[model samples]
Target: VAGQFGKSAVAAAPTLLTKELTFNFQQKRSIQLAMVELEDMPVRSEAEELVFSLLIAILPERLPEQTQLLSNYPNPFNPETWIPFELSQDSKVSVTIYNVAGTPVRNISVGYLQAGSYVSQLKSVYWDGKSDTGERVSSGTYFYQIRAGDYTETRKMVILK
Candidate 1:
């Protein structure tokens, strides 16, 4: 899938008839892709300068300044949702879900996590609309509180039937 210099060059390489991917070349092909031709070679640069430029170009988003709780997805969810947040530093984390009457329903203890992001669904805390006793919760308003070491914050969400 590699593209040419600023231009898209599309051609199929030799592949087997099966669904599995292949990297080895076979001599049974009739057509072939263009061969790579280089007119100039790479010039050597300072290691620090190359590293700094690469970092600056690739790292556009920095770490969070302060640890805090972020909003959960699909506020009025049916069966499941994810809670996303970022941490300023390493600390133990926990998420507790409470009902409208302030009674705790679920508790998720996320041991020690490093300082970074838990914002993506794959890395964030997940709730399956179940209580700590492993029973599904009813449709209603719910509050979630996050405790990360010395930092604490709370947010609200809703569950739908």
Candidate 2:
């Protein structure tokens, strides 16, 4: 509270009147803490500083890491197949199954997933040789792709009748 900006630092922060205590990085090179309370409530100064510093320090490591999608198991699958992959960091990901002709068939995941290796079994939703609409058809080769953050990989499989 007593460095580059001078004692008037507290007065300059009109909008920060709501900052449980404001640290103005733009106005000064050093840090200063003011007792100005946002509401009539109280705050634990040490706890707030600890939390803020920890978050600021970890910012560089928060990005999702790279990953690889492994090939599906039982290449000539009939009723089901297991797809596996690995991620080096936490990420939002999705595994999509596609027919031989390149049509999205099913979503193996519904939301974000954690980092690490994973394997998911996809049931043959319509291997009656048809798609979701309920018509009979033929199949030879199909594919599935796993997308994690900015990384994406597609692997092929054979579906035989």
Candidate 3:
């Protein structure tokens, strides 16, 4: 690959790169690949310049293109609710619920989730109207925020009990 990095023009010996990737997904995706390989083996950066591109990125079906926090199900609930969201890339997900007064009422540790749509009930986070200390919460209006990679969003929900 030959292109200007910034102000310097860099070129290298012509080498072939075989990359197999398919991403049939919803709108909104970012994909970039850069590496150096020679004859199915690794090559020093000083030896070559190449950019890898996938084929499925041009299609549309299997992956998510951006991170997002969708609305929760049964927003006005009795004692529990499910939070559904999606990620554009692999990330350590963290969910925190805050009361109307802007104080955290519950913190959900979601650990790691792969890049995809987690819109289904089974894939979403479940909060049993309880705080981190495992006590029931008196709810009217509450805020739920999710942190996935560099993306964050907060939505409102109600507990009718």
Candidate 4:
């Protein structure tokens, strides 16, 4: 089978196996058979090199080490403040601001973002200290929650009207 396929196809087959195959007995047998067939082929340095390159290209890219929610600047803000966060990979992000009584005042949906650091300034993700209906909130403590993929975090802020 290895001899019948081109070098690129043969090289990519192993990568596909690891990604799509379960580690069950049948899968194991298939892997072993593939390895045996690969070994039986005549030694060709160029083919080996192509396989090596293909394997490297087929590997998945590295994800972020961790997701983080940084403290918002100007904690005791007047009408607005910047909320910052970092993501290791693409994710759907939602930010919600709740009053001290736990009532949701503002909900900001950031949609999908790629892996990187994002600030309210650069990304325009800031909350204008207003309710969803565009009314300014009263002065007091409030909670801001950030939900990104599997990560969830809540932080406190104050509004000094």
The TM-score leader among the candidates is 1
lDDT of 2: 0.54
TM-score versus the correct structure, for each prediction: 0.66, 0.48, 0.63, 0.59
* TM-score of candidate 4 against the unseen true structure: 0.59
Give the per-residue lDDT digits (tens) of candidate 1, residues 12-58: 11112223533332211111111101112244345433433333333
Q: How many residue pairs clash in each candidate at the backbone level?
A: 0, 0, 4, 0
Best by lDDT: 4
Identify the runs in model 1 with alpha carbons over 4 angstroms from their true place. 1-54
Candidate 4 residue-wise lDDT, 1-161, digit = tens: 86666766766676777576445534444444444454457774776556445544443332335788888888899989999988866789999999888999999999988765686587746988889999999999999999999999999999997
Candidate 1 has its poorest 10 consecutive residues by lDDT at 30-39
List CA RMSD, all candidates: 12.6, 15.0, 10.8, 12.3
For model 4, the stretches where C-alpha displacement exceeds 4 angstroms are 1-64
Q: Which candidate would rank higher by TM-score, 2 or 4?
A: 4
What tens-digit string does per-residue lDDT give for candidate 2 at 6-95?
424433443344335443433221121121121122655654644444333322122113477777677777655677776666667777
Error of 2 at 94 (Å): 1.1
Task: Give Cα distance to truth, residue 42, candidate 2, Å.
Answer: 47
- Candidate 4 has its poorest 10 consecutive residues by lDDT at 55-64
Candidate lDDT values, in order? 0.72, 0.54, 0.71, 0.75
